[model samples]
Target chain A: MPLRTLLQADDVRRAITRMAHELVEHDPDADRLLLLGIPTRGAVLARRLAAEVARIAGREVPVGVLDVTLYRDDLGTQPTRATGRTDVPADVDGATVVLVDDVLFSGRTVRAALDAVTALGRPAVVRLAVLVDRGHRELPIRPDSVGRNLPSAKSERVRVLLTETDGRDEVTIE
Target chain B: MSDHLLSTRDLSRDAAVALLDVAEDMADTQRRTVKKLPTLRGTTVVNLFFEDSTRTRISFEAAAKRLSADVITFSAKGSSVSKGESLQDTAQTLQAMGADGIVIRHQASGAAAVLATSGWTRAAVVNAGDGTHEHPTQALLDAFTIRKRRFGAGSRGRDLAGLDVVIVGDVLHSRVARSNVWLLTTLGATVRLVAPPTLLPTHIESWPVEAGTDLDAAIADGPDVVMMLRVQRERMTEAFFPSAREYAALYGLSAARADRLRADALVMHPGPMNRGLEIAGSVADSPRSTVLEQVENGIAVRMAVLYDVLAGERTA
Candidate 1:
């Protein structure tokens, strides 16, 4: 399969900076906001977003990692992989949670993340955030904060590589 | 990636590592206030035991419950099996009742294998313990505990490569010993069996492990893990050793021998311990001991096994 560079490192940085600004603009009280990254790359993205939010708001925003593997509906149908860490640093009750992911495609992952988060505690408001919003959503869910909107065919895979996980920041389509 | 985990031999290096990694995730769940996962919400797991077990049974039950699976425990004591019903009958009945997974512990050597292949049920068969043949889950938990203690947080995706493990006790009647020998060896660990001539199994040379009659010699090798098998007093009909005292003198892990072990070396026991006979109480309760951790790891390991069998994608 041939590889295509959808977003370079500078592009990803710009997108993240803009998304962080958008997040700070929407939430005047950033202390009540919690950024939770879905595992693998999402957790890394959440950390990056938290840093960006801290830079803009001048206050630290709590970041947590939520692994949606256990809440996934396609567990038996797809190949089983090892579950990642689901570490919610604090009680999310009455907190506005921004569920962050690297790429938003089918939206099933976000749905699973919702199920996982709901099981932990009741958040006052749960919003979705994605670095790249690739339009192929199957579930009735949409990202509240999107870094980049990249429309592509459903057959093409959108691979998001972060420096923390993949040792480089780039988005690829193959 | 076979649907059924009948023996340790059935697991490849990658599969075993994957199971351990998954168990680590399960262990992570225990730290949370809400330790339940929505993975197997609608699935039903049946604990079918022909033999009496407290730890293994409870571990499986807790594992299944933690994963949000409905659990039904059926022991042979009050069940139809006590009334002369065959294994096939009981299994078929459980299958008819819509069991998604069956964690079976039987006194027969191949009972679990039979259930997995007999077409009596489509549910995944996890062998908790089967006679003197294998206790796959015990070995898995033991491995998990050992790896966790040795490597800490960096234990993920790692095997027991080059680690020396000494399994001491009744190898003849111990399914724990049998399972650990295969699994530890397969994971690239050097395994040595320390037992008396009578306590050792027949044709033991066929096994891929170093056999020795001296406990002190095995301990002097500075093993990373020392796993002591239980010595059942009830199974000692023909006298495997001269007496309990002599067995304790030679093969038993006394306090003195425990002190001689390397500070980092871990002491392990498959539980329901014969306190004074196989391992001294101090050693069993020592800081180096992984007995309690093994029990805790049992739930996570069994959870991983069930998840792999029931929810994991089938391997081609």
Candidate 2:
């Protein structure tokens, strides 16, 4: 299969900057804002977005990692996955929590993340931010902020590569 | 990652390390206030024991409960096994009740192996301990405890390589010793079995371990870990040693013996200890002892094993 580049390094950077500004604008309370990244590529994207948020809002937001492997619904039917570290930095109660991920596909991951976050503590509100939104949501979930809305077929694979993990910054569909 | 964990002899180095790494994750989850996970929510686990056990049963129960699996415990003393029901009948009855996993501790050796391979039930079989055959989870917990103490946070994806381990006393009827011998050796640790001639198993020369009769000589060598095996009085149909006092004097980890050990050397004991017979009370309570840590790690290791058998694809 041929691979198609959806967003290059510059495009990725520009999109992240825009998303960061949008997050700051939506929730002006920077003190109550928390950014939690899903594992692997999503975690790197989260850190990058945190840096951009600090640059735009002139204040640092707490960032942590939340892995939803254990909360997955298809645990027994499929192979068991290794759990990543879940480091909740601040008190989640009464906070504006943003779950950041690299790609938004079936939304099962986001569903698990919702449960994982709720299990930690009750947040005032929970929103989602994604770098790429490939629309094939199995759950009734939508991203609050999206970098690029790439409509694609079900058979294709969407992969996001970041400089922190893959030594590059791009989004590809193959 | 086998379908059934009957013995550590079937576990490769990679398989053992993978399980340990997963146990590390489980241990991390235990540090949280909300320690329960919904991974095995709808599955049912049965604890079938033809032998009596306190810590092993509770550890397995806690492990299954933490993962949100329903547990049913069956003991031979009060169960239908006392009414002349055979093993097959009991196993089939549990299978009919929709048991997804069975953790069994039996008095007969190879009982778990038979349950796993006899086509009686489709559920995964985990050997709690079968007679003197093996207790894979206990060894895995011991390995986890050792790795955690030695490497701390850097313990993930590592084996017990180059660690010198000395196992003392009652090897003939110790499933813990048998399991640890295979697992520790497979993980690249050199193990020495120290016991009286009668307590050592027959044909010990064929096992992948160094054997000795003198505990003082083994301790003087300054091993990285000194594990004490409990002297099971109930299992002693024949006198394995001359007397309890002589046994304590020679093989017991007294305060003096513990003091002679290197400061960094770890002291380990599988539970239900005869306090003054196999290990001194002071030594068992000292900072060097990992007996409590072993019990704590047992829950995590059993959780990892249950997850490995019931949820994960077989990697063995």
Candidate 3:
């Protein structure tokens, strides 16, 4: 009996590579481009995207991590995900900020990311990019670029596991 | 102990001092050209504030940002929490969402303590402030402030050993006093509690500290430090003391009373100070005062606290 693979490791790579090229093509001037990874799994995805963007764009873009755990209203008052901090590199002024994350559901994470990004500095324009867009829009948030649009029930949990941290590269609905 | 920092009593003397020392490193961020770090690089920190507080919320926000952690600021003003959702439901929600750390300020004193015990969120729990129970970071910052003013910033990596200190005023309702008593006692500081008979906890004698109701003598004893606590008017309707003016005239750190202490002694109060109540403005702003130092050290103490709880650095 074989194990299940929701979105395999290879599948994630191919989609993000295409997403990276689209990002470069859309922005053109890659100099002002910086990659920000939301914590836990989003950080890994952002690092991958930065690597892919480097191969395609012939440049190693500055990458930063945003941990927006402190902004979630659900913690203690209800249920909440694990949270960290927001780390933007020194040179975000007048740059195009592409915030990256693994999953987009309820759009709260993106909303928090926007709040975190705003605190960093004035990025010329901010963009949202995600690996999976599990459509359950509780807020008016839409990603500028998305890897896969997967539908999930509000009761179900969608977890993104990476080999770097989770010992496997896959997304599972558990 | 689990990785959560729910209170100061949970920390050992070495652990508490290490946290303060790490905070010393975090304080250097203020002197940096770029006031940020990637130390907590891929971590998420959630600020779940059930209570409204501006200075503390903003200070934690600034501290988290300086450490480069993702911060989600959640205030349940008109949110789902107002819908009467259970605390378990809320914590599980954050768990499902993947929160790494949760900084919560609730109206309940043991709320943070309960959350840390509950298997709700796998994230590290840092209590920002809780209902009249304990504010560990505030106490730590108070200690840090005292240390810096008495010894200077270069006195980093030091512990509060052999410091004789007396905390007067309202101890029964002060979370700050509770935290200080625990941490300072652990750090080998000989602590004495001076309060009105009604203002001191009955079980306070269980702790390893001297307790009394004589304020002038506590100061007259020439202790190395005198800490006056604010009389929470809202928390008390009936008089804990006879009158505000009388409390000042009798127990307050007036200029003449202030002159009774050792010339090198320190005076402290955890402000929002009442000018003529527990502390006089002149005494609060005096040369020996560490009130302002407490406010500034609050940032570093909070930074040290957050970093200690979330740094993933541990030793047996």
Provide the overall lDDT of each model, using Cα atoms, as 2-decimal numbers: 0.90, 0.92, 0.79
Model 3 TM-score relative to the real fold? 0.63
Where in model 1 is the C-alpha error above 4 Å? A1-9, A59-64, A87-96, A118-125, A152-156, A161-174, B313-316
Candidate with better DockQ, 2 vs 3: 2
Residue B67, model 3: Cα distance from true site in angstroms: 0.7
Task: Give the candidate order by descending DockQ.
Answer: 1, 2, 3
Provide the DockQ value for model 3: 0.02
Q: Which candidate, 1 or 3, has the higher lDDT?
A: 1
Isolated chain A: TM-score per model? 0.96, 0.97, 0.90
Q: Mind giving the per-residue lDDT tens digits that candidate 3 earns over B195-277?
A: 88988898986888999988877877778889988888877867787788878876788988898889999998887789888
Candidate 1, residues A57-138: lDDT per residue as tens digits?
A: 8888899999989889888787665688777877888888999999999889999999888877788889888999989889
On DockQ, the stronger of 1 and 3 is 1
Worst 10 residues of 1 chain B by lDDT: B307-316
Give a tens-digit lDDT track for model 1, residues B256-278: 99988999999999889999999
User: Which residue window of length 10 is worst by lDDT in model 2 chain B?
Assistant: B307-316
Interface RMSD of each: 2.0, 2.6, 9.8
**Relative to the unseen true structure, what is the C-alpha lDDT of residue A108 in candidate 1, on a scale of 0 to 100?**
92
Ranking by lDDT: 2, 1, 3
